[model samples]
Target: MANPYQPIEAQILKTIDETPTIRTFVLKPEQDVPFLAGQFVELTVPGHGEAPFTPSSSHFERETIEVTIMKVGRATTALFGLKAGDSVGIRGPYGQRYPLESFEGKDIYLVGGGVGLAPLRSLFLSLVHEIDKYRRVFLRYGARTPEEIVYKYLIPQWEKLKKVDIDLSVDVGDKSWVRKVGVVTCLMDDIPCDETSSIAVVCGPPVMMKFVTFKLVDAGFKPENIYLSMETNMSCGLGQCGHCRLGPYFTCKDGPVLTWEQIKDIPEPFV
Candidate 1:
């Protein structure tokens, strides 16, 4: 039987605090929500309108969806205030996804800072399930401070995953925290990568991404081999609105993820 239409609503089942300022929402959709890692969706609250968010859950499991959001904007502040039984409208599973196969059999690097870890979390979970497929996997996560780490509950277990190299850093350290103390860019010095056979995925604030890309290139990574997740003030996930458009490219349709070489020449890729 062909379904007449797809339902766009999802009921909030649970809310977990991944960090002091970040929350993960578990939503069960009226219909199955299908998507790939690195893709984002437009979440609406009826009269309050829509905002973009990337699902933190892997594509391999879609029965329940997870979206981790930082309460930095008005829409997110409202979203954070919602309870377990609340409902929100979601329009997609949209945008081009990260190219997972490109990293197969090659050394891989993930560079994330602050809330940038949200989308990459999905890719990490998916890779863990099929750990043997890649040569090496390294994760470099940086936060503004010790308390800003998002996956406090899951990071320890993730570090134990076979063949996974997890390293964390903080711009500012606290007494109780006993790990590297420096900017996320400092972690790049420790990644043992062969540019010819490695790929890097980078996600973070504009300033962070700018510097991380510089470090990766300095480390011999090709510009094209660096994948970046660029975020903007996204309104429509399907490209109906121009808010997220970057010159000739419609980020909502073409990408939230693009290889650095693909847009390096664009004067203001982020503007």
Candidate 2:
């Protein structure tokens, strides 16, 4: 029997560059697809091939889905040429979403870098829907340079919210830019967190993960309380394919979200 929830090919409604190398593709699926925040989908560009991408849109909306893609390799290069009305395949809303249940009445910190913010944005928007559920929410985001940052439009709105704390940074800045300058970890120094009561969700490049994890540890975040989104070259999201296997783990399956405590013994360099 065919899976009732199989992905339907969607039409591209718009493609806008969020940054120098990152672009957000707005898609209208043939049918409505609902997914929790933090899940990923497999996107196919027909003959050009496919890859995994987390939806950047809010989980509350289903009429349209947004995916932010970074031009990294051949598949992504083909993706850049996609235009409004072009057809593309989207197959999921898979994997785990941020554990909202654990965040109740606790300080929640979102640490994201570059395209990693794509997924974090979904989780953040969900949190905003029920603002009072969390005691304090902190968003710390960074990018290679000022121009490389995504979601420029939403920053002001989030900042306006009394319950949310938004801090941003850039690895390198130009004369016109004015904000914190350094890695996303730099913002950590300013946020107040309770080691046992707060949850820190981080996503970014592999090296950035290493350093940020160290900072979170030094600041007293419990190893298990620190969640992460890992990346790998994935295809055939169903664990049958070996494309994304890391030993006994499948990044597309058991996680793209895990705490350091779960995979610390894997001997794999995870992000």
Candidate 3:
């Protein structure tokens, strides 16, 4: 069996600047690394070390994986210094994936904030690929400011798709911005999906996820139908490390994708 700990080399094909602190790296791994939507990978910047990140690209496109990273700390900072043609190590398509099968024939509501939109992008693209299987798709996203919104170029294309609706908001807007100004949960006020039959997926900062979870529950969505992407401090991609334990579950093993029903009783689940 192949060693799960060993990382395969992937060459950076291109990089796109998303924000001052965030950039998207397009990488071509030496071998195909197929991953389901919401699964994460450990990216190694050689001598610096590896950090966990979920691919921002569609899972259907395995030839090249796009990872959107924010420059937060050591490993990410090191990754930023490298450019196209550079090589990095990639390990895993780890953790649980979003349950796409259950979403068929149902309205799909995706709520994301800031960089949390990254993983949701993967799910969104997958849904778009198989658009006919689902009912309607709704994307409601929010960023701290207009400048921090990722995938600025793709939103228009997504909006043009049939049965796909998008709502955008910014905490604070600039003169050039014309979208709604408020928290992401504000968009929940008039959700068009049937609360009883739709599935809601959320990914964002812990605080944002907390409030969104409350809003969805208050809006009458079942806990089991509300999925949360809890990509917290995962160390070893396997369950061996206790770094990402949340009550009885390991975020790295049992999930990075967990239903609200599974974690509602856990203390500070969003944290």
Error of 3 at 270 (Å): 1.5
For every model shown, what is its TM-score relative to the native structure?
0.94, 0.95, 0.98
Query: Would you list the clashing residue pairs of candidate 1?
Result: none
Best by lDDT: 3
Candidate 3, 1-271: lDDT as tens digits: 9887899999999999998998999999999888999899999999999999999999999789999998999999999999999999998889988888999999999999999999899999999999999999999999999999999999999999999999999999999998899999878899898998899999999999999999999999999999999967888898887998888999899988899999999888876
- Misplaced by over 4 Å in model 3 are none
How many backbone collisions does model 2 have? 0
Single out the weakest 10-residue window by summed lDDT for candidate 2. Answer: 262-271
User: Residue 187 in candidate 1 has what lDDT?
Assistant: 82
Q: In model 3, what are the clashing residue pairs, if there are any?
A: none
In the range 1-271, model 1's lDDT, one tens digit per residue, is 5331232889999999988889999998888878888788878765565788878888888788899998887788888878899999877878998777877888889999999998889888887778798888899999989788998889999998898999999999999989999999888776676776698988888889989988888888988889898877666666767887776777888888888888888887754
Candidate 1 Cα errors over 4 Å, as ranges: 1-7
Ranking by lDDT: 3, 1, 2
The reply for model 2, stretches above 4 Å from the true place, is 3-7
What is the Cα-based lDDT of residue 234 in candidate 3? 88
- Candidate 1: give its CA RMSD in angstroms: 2.3
Question: How would you encode candidate 2's per-residue C-alpha lDDT over 1-271 as one tens digit per residue?
Answer: 7673356799999998998789999999887767788788888887798788888888888899999889998888899988998999888767777778888999988899999998888888888888889888889999989889898887888899978988899999889778999988888885576877689888889888878887887888888888888877677777667777765778788777878777667785563
